[model samples]
Structure formats: structure tokens, C-alpha cells
Target: MRLATVADMPRIGTLMRVSGAELFPRFYTERQAASAAIYLTEPDITLIKDGTYFVYEAGGEIVACGGWSKRNKLYTGSGSQQDDGRLLDPATEPARVRAMFVRADWTRRGLAKAILDACVKAAREEGFRSLSLMATLPGVPLYHAFGFQETRQTMVPLPDGVQLEGVEMTYELSQ
Candidate 1:
């Protein structure tokens, strides 16, 4: 697999949007789904284009993506609240990994793990102390395998008063 760039966002977004179950919760909620879809569909959900975004591409297809948002204001403090890497210290928090996604077809193939490792390594290389992610309902297990643990749960308000349940997770580096 090869790493992707800003150009791969649309394809990556489409991948998750297509795998509705893996993305939009099985329980249908228009507001929740719409809000989640809108944010994740963007290339910078993890603020990659404006910072560090990583994608896993195989056979010329973008199968997975994750980003290490360096700036706190990327998505109105999203990069700050969920990214524990930043909580450690500003100087040590250049990159906060977020919005990790692997195609449904690519599941159990180690793409998620690979993409996660890449994001962590990128953050550490940039001198970040830890990496953070807001684990989606289906993404918790993957993050756990990479030494991330739940730090908090955040509820994202949607248009119809529904909420998207997300767990804020963090992976601290040995440094």
C-alpha cells in the first residue's frame, strides 16, 4: 500500500460513505448521519491538507486515510480537544492523528493498523508526545490494538437534536 495525498480525499470519503454500516450507525438518525458524513467527507476532517494526512492506497485505490492535525483551530478546536498529543505540550504537539478510516473491503487486512502506525510515527517524528483520535463506533478496536485507550466520550450535536457518540482516545509515545 502507498500513502495518499490531498487528491485522495474524495475517494476516501466515498469509500466510508458507501460502507454505510461501518460509518453511519446501523440505527438511522438523519441528523447524526448527515453531520458525521459532512465532516468526515471533507479532506481535512483530521485537518490533513492543512497539516499531516495519511492514506493507504492499493491497486490505485484509496483504501484508508488518517491525519495528524498540527494546528488546534483546524476544526474549531477539534484538533485540540480530541488530540491528547497536543495536551502534553504545544511544542510537543505538532501533529494530532484523527479521522482514521479503512475501506470496508479493506477491513481485517491490517490497513487500519498500518495507517495508524504511520500516523503515530509521523506525529513522533514531528516531536509530538502523543497522538489522539475520536474513535467511531466501529473504530475502537483498531485503535486499542495500537496502544490507544479511551480518555473521554464526546457527543456531537446534530441538526435534529440527535447526537453522534464518539470516544476520545489517545496514544502516548515513549519519547
Candidate 2:
């Protein structure tokens, strides 16, 4: 398992398991829009620029990945990169865990946890005290197991006007 650079974005973009348009409204219960967030392609650019991505693998195959954004000097809003609610304190680095998924063949293994551990370690090393993520329904328990608490429910408002229901979660990485 290792970290992925934006060079790995195309591959990671392909590996991400999407729930499909109907599934979004089915599982978390969201309203429809012109497009869907079923895949990472919708917001690929922002996901790349906003954060660094980590990839998990076995035998050189990319299995899972998630992105962590370090707080930047500027704040645009919740919908873009460099948006940290406009805080300038470096230690207050806010992060986002985006596009995390394990290959279908790799499920039930501890690989997800391992990848998650790496993300947390990197966040801490980057001087961040906390990290946030939008948990997919099936991934909620996994995040909780790693000490992430539910903060609120959210929606990733796609540029195409589609919004996917997500659980807003926060993880405190320090004492």
C-alpha cells in the first residue's frame, strides 16, 4: 500500500465504485438533478487540486484511494479546493477524505483500515489536528471504527446540479 499522486488520478478515477444515479436516491435518499455523483469524474479537477490522494494496492494493482486536503490560504466555499472556511491558522488544517474505495475482490480484508491509517498519519504529519469526510452509507461503520464521529448529514452538490446524500464526519487526530 502507498500514496498516490495526481498522476494516479486517472486510474483511481476508474477504480472508484459508484452507486449509480438511481442508487443515490435509493440508498441515502436524495433528490435528482441533471447529473450524478456516482463517479469521481464529476469533480475530478477539484478533488485533485484540493487534496493529495493515497492509493492502496496488492501486486501493483490500485485497490483503494482517498484524498486529503491541507488547508490553503484562501477560502472559496464548500464546493471548491482551497476552501477551509477561511481560517489561516496553519495548525488548524482542515482535511477532506475523498474518493475512498477498495476493489470488489479485496473486500473484507483489513486493507481499508491500513489505507485509512496512512491517511491519518499523513494528516497528522502535515500538522493537522482534525480531518473530515463524507461517509458513504456502507462506509459509515468503517469510519466510526477509526474514531470518526458523525457531525451532520451533507450533500455533495455536483456542478451539474445533482446532489448526493452523505454523512458529514469528523476525526480528531490529537489529544
Best-matching candidate per TM-score: 1
| Clash totals in order | 1, 0
RMSD of each: 4.3, 4.4
TM-score, one value per model: 0.76, 0.72
Instruction: Tell how far residue 6 is off in model 1, in angstroms.
Output: 3.1
Residue-level lDDT tens digits of model 2 in 1-175: 6656667766775666342332333455444422443433232444455455667767777766665656442111235554443433436556666556666567668777877787788778877788877775657878888889999987756555666566878889873
TM-score (C-alpha, index-matched) for candidate 2: 0.72
lDDT value, residue 123 of candidate 1: 69
- Give the residue spans of candidate 1 off by over 4 A: 20-22, 27-31, 45-51, 73-94, 159-161
* Number of the top-ranking candidate, with lDDT as the measure: 1
- Residue pairs with clashing backbones, model 2: none
Question: Candidate 2 lDDT (Cα, whole model)?
Answer: 0.61
lDDT of model 1, residue 146: 73
lDDT score, candidate 1: 0.63
Return the lDDT, model 2, position 175: 37
